[model samples]
Target: MDASHHPCGGIPSRLPGGGGAPRPDARGWPKGCPSTVARERIRVPEATRRVKPAAACIVRHNYYPDTHVRRDAEALVEAGYDVSVVSLRRPGQAAREALCGVNVYRLPMQHRRGSSLRYAWEYTLFLFLAFLTVTALHVKKRFRVVEVDNMPDILVLSALVPRLLGVRVILYVFDNMPELLAYLRGWSARHPVVRFLAFLERLSARFADRVIVTQEMPRRAMASRGVPRHKIAVVLNSADETAFVPSAAPDAGRRDVFQIVSHGVILERYGVQVLIEALPSIAAQVPGVEVQVFGEGEYRRALEEQARRNGTTQLVSFRGFAPFDELIATLARADVGYVGMLNDLVLPNKLMEYVALGVPVTASRWPTFLHYFPDEAVAYFRPGDPEDLAAAIVRMHRNPASSRARARRAKELYQDYRWSVQREVYLGVYSELLNGVVGASAMGSRVGAAPYQRS
Candidate 1:
């Protein structure tokens, strides 16, 4: 259950091109060019002029339209601050686009960099390009807040630039970066890059004006690492109720069979195999339970193999990730939402999204769940315990009324965890940064660089 100790599937060390490992780039640096101007060319609008440049910039190397980043950045924009996101653009998306009135700039990524060295070089180049974009955007318009979210804690170092420039740095810690690295190496020897990243994480946490984590576990972990509780705010992932709300019920014919659905990246930590192996037992007990997995990842082939091995290939189907609207449609059709994450340090955000859609969620039990979900709210089975999971699935199938009630309750509870709440928390953070109430020196008064703690 402790994935921090699990060995990760081996990944190549040198990406193609032998470029340095990718790190988040400096704000306002030009994309793909070193000598180009780093600042923005556009003039600041009068409406935005009243609002001081945010010391914080939401930074992530991950793609845009990522639910949380987009939602948070949009909320920040509504609160009247300059927000720019630095991330990789998929081949199809344009280099720049304004969505929900927020400026989103994407840099080209070299996915072809097959080796780790090439990947690192490409990513570093990405960072530099992103920095140029950020600089141009910021100089053209002042920004005061620099927020770093997503994985690869090396990006945390980006906070240093803003801090040096007198801007407040906020760490929106989502996943634990070092734990992820160790997992990749099968929890074996630590790599120098991982060590350096760990070092950077410590420095960033120590100096960050505020620390925002997704769940209580990370907050406590950060606290143990010396981040004060006051400086840390627990910002759990919230569902976009407006986008995910259930639509009118489909016809009884369309709902003739019970549909169980799961989505997102299909990776080891998602524990899809356990669920597949449990299907035979579930089928023996429940007459019409069908499990559909949405999304693809490293573990997909293994999952297919398990389904074939278990002879439940007929009941289990692999449906890859769908567009947002289509995903909502699938959620609407799904009677039970299967929520899984290899019992590990991080909680699965999809579970929250599932609950928001008002679907009864059945998940692999993890310690992280205790922090946010009530025992009654979810039907939890031991991590990787096929029998327990099958039994839980059977229990839900046999008790449709109870399942329906639970789903209704989950939807009602979803309001408390909605972005409406997160918006206010972010606004408070921005206000704190703008007032300069918290300074870099104050941050230094906190603990020094400390290694990330494992469960």
Candidate 2:
């Protein structure tokens, strides 16, 4: 297969070609990096891979290298499934390429989260384009499964043809879109836009043969809307113990300055703004305190402006993204790793990353976070409260021995959520869906040929 250009959209392909190791760009946040997991996150040679491939088509609106979607694709491939990712294309990325062992096709469209109408256009446009692309790919070689990772939520509807051919459709929802938009935009649950989003979300769940949510809250939320319990899978965003090999570290006593680290897209709902608010208070209590933020987003520029406005730019630094190994090493060396998001329902990916690296952690205190992370495992602070977060940081600073002990406890608890342990659940769900176990009325919701038979 000549996987070099987009299958559709006559927009004459443009490419800066392959992705080299990340170097500082003008904005300084690894600007041109093509994907998050650049074969650095997964590796399985063709000679060693299983001969029989359970063919799969995975779709997402995000970049091809999104950690969660990439991890899921890697898991499917590891379980003898041939996986192909349909993802968005940025400036520097090629329209098509292979990462690790999974084939990827990038569509010629990109959308940033914004207004209600803007989201509507972007989602509808991508849905039409992706539907055409997947249909064409399906004719080339049949796929037994189509998995859609959500943001718009209803992208699974793009698998119309395959679903007609009896291919199972799985809705792999990473975050609850309605709740996320509500929090980000400060919209009430009963608001028109929020209710509309909730309706779309329900449509997406109803359209899928199986729904995979990152945490228990979403699963229960879906169940409350009448989706069967068995149809929903609770797959937390846990670290893979085998994949992350921690680097050697020095004693905390040797460091004179108190350093804190946070990474990933600097979104407003993540409450990184709260981190900015806490900096002055933290500096007052501990003069040498510095917060190193890696990764970039529109919110990052806002954060930098906020730091300048507060005259605390010296206390915060935007270090930008590094190669996977170096990024982990940076966190492993930090005194404290923080997950300061405003929402409590979703699991913080960075929290798991912090736990895996055995880094002393301080995170927003919420029922959802505490459900998975116990009090002894991680220090907590009130979400959206700068004073509380600063106090949490100071507590960790004053008692290094206690925090280290908590990190050790967290690491032991994280063992169960590893990809090694969790992959089986994903496979089991796919296996059931493939066997024609329509836990819900997927066929009726689908606009395809009558019902499919048991394979």
lDDT of 1 by residue, 379-434 (tens): 88888888998888888888877877877777676676776565565566666566
Model 2: per-residue lDDT, tens digit, 1-455?
00121111011112233254334432222344323444356454555443345678998876665556666787666555778999888777778787656788989987565666777788888899999999998887578889987766878889988988888898887767777667767889888977887888888888788898877778878887777787788776776665455555645565568889988666676788898888998988875888888776557889999999987898898976555656667778888988887877577767887888889999888887787788999999988999999999998988889999999999888887666656666666776666655543221121111112223
Off by over 4 Å in 1: 1-56, 111-137, 188-197, 250-256, 437-455
Residue 219: error of model 1 in Å?
A: 0.8
Give lDDT for model 2: 0.72
Clashes of each: 41, 0
